[model samples]
Target: MARLTNSMFPSIPSFTDRFFGGNLMDWNNWNFAGIDSTLPAVNVKESDSDFKIEVAAPGLKKSDFKLNYDKGRLTISSEKSDEKSEKNGKEVTRREFSYQSFQRSFTIPDDIVNADKISAKYKDGILHVTLPKREEAKVKTVKEIKVS
Candidate 1:
């Protein structure tokens, strides 16, 4: 009978493939060096009297938020940090620290928005901002003219 050789089984992987393993794509890897992907969601509504803005940010205290308005621009930002440490007989056993921050800005129409009447409140993990409109900006009633 003829001698059987490796060429007879061409479907089998080579030695390098078995030793180094097969190349596979990594789907769970993430890059953190750029802008953060975690930003609070927000909703905005406009009515005849005012405009409303709601931001969803859970587990944050009211004092953690800062709101600023200048030159018809409104900015909202928050920063928080927490640090914990445990010591046993002057030997630190465990330590943990965390920090988070975000900022969002909006532009208000100068002739329509009344900056002095703007108000904000935080309740139940929601930040509500009310931007009152100027009197002239309110919707006016339709006038009917009688033709002679």
Candidate 2:
């Protein structure tokens, strides 16, 4: 008689691993491996006037990032890659350069409008997204006019 063994995990890749890396363990898909360094972190804050978002992407230029807004959704994405070496130097030891990409998206609140007017800035490894509230969304200070 022969005994058979089964693996606890299926041979097929998990849905999360296929889309998000296996090492990434969170609701948000963020993986920091096989590249220069870890991916940038993102922070979002909201106020009565507007919503602010910031991402920390080190060693990345402003040109590397792409921002898109459509149907009340905003997406930020970037891809990084290293070229293969042609010349042999000192019996090449270890290589770390590899293809890595990061993507994140956020939904625009219904209270906000005019996404086209949104502004963004990238400086010192930090990306800032400013979503200004529309006139109607802003707080109002009404004054009654005196009538004679």
Per-prediction TM-score to the true structure, in the order listed: 0.70, 0.62
Per-residue alpha-carbon lDDT of candidate 1 for residues 18-104, written as tens digits (9 for 90 to 100): 423422243244222222334687888999899899988778999999999888788999999999999998998999998888898
The sequence of per-residue lDDT tens digits that candidate 2 reaches over residues 1-148 is: 2222334666755544444443445745544433334556778998777888999887788888899988778899999798565446767555557776788899986457567678999988899999888878887778899999
**Candidate 1 lDDT trough over 10 residues, lowest sum:** 27-36
Scored by CA lDDT, what does every candidate get?
0.79, 0.74
Best by lDDT: 1
What's model 1's overall lDDT?
0.79
